[model samples]
Target: MSTDNSEHMRTIDRWLAGEVVNNTIGIKVVGGPFDGRTKIVLLGEDGRPPAVIRASGGPAGPSRHAYEAVRSTDVRAGWIYTYTGPEPATES
Candidate 1:
């Protein structure tokens, strides 16, 4: 099986083993303004991430940036999110 598939299976195995898997998942962003950034995002009850994510602008201001999930891939360490662009009016 592919490495990606293996990683997914491991996650399932952990759940089956009664391990308290964390709802937060690591994600590497690709493309868009926040490209090449990595962050930890919350996952839904169904073990899926939100279609869109908002990141804090930190230091620059209290504004937040939005990134739409274009694609995702499972890896041993975490998942990857390919973002397209920041959503309009997402900043504050």
Candidate 2:
């Protein structure tokens, strides 16, 4: 991997490790802006969790996921600014 990519992963790792997104519930990961990359962004309801996660391979990067809790008088923006991966899976 290149230096830029390395730095990107490192930074993302640190953020993931920190108090950004929570793992309380299973997350939904999707592809990212960059190729071979995936990311998850959270816009907490009522102004709570607003975090971003982006990862790539290099030792192979990790998958990303985010979830938002619902609250009255608030609308989550996570869906608005998230990566649109390939089509969803469906049962035949």
Which tens-of-lDDT digit does each residue in 33-81 have in candidate 2?
3432323444356434444443333332343333222232222222222
- Listed in order, each prediction's TM-score against the native is 0.51, 0.26
Best by lDDT: 1
Q: Poorest 10 consecutive residues of model 2 by lDDT?
A: 72-81
> Model 2 residue 10 lDDT?
71
The model with the greatest TM-score is 1
Model 1, span 1-92: residue lDDT tens? 99999998887666433233577655667665567666556677866667777776644354566766544334443445665444456333
Runs in model 2 with CA error above 4 Å?
Answer: 19-39, 42-47, 50-67, 70-92
Every model's Cα RMSD, please? Answer: 9.7, 12.0
Q: Give the clashing pairs for model 1.
A: none
Global Cα lDDT for candidate 2: 0.38
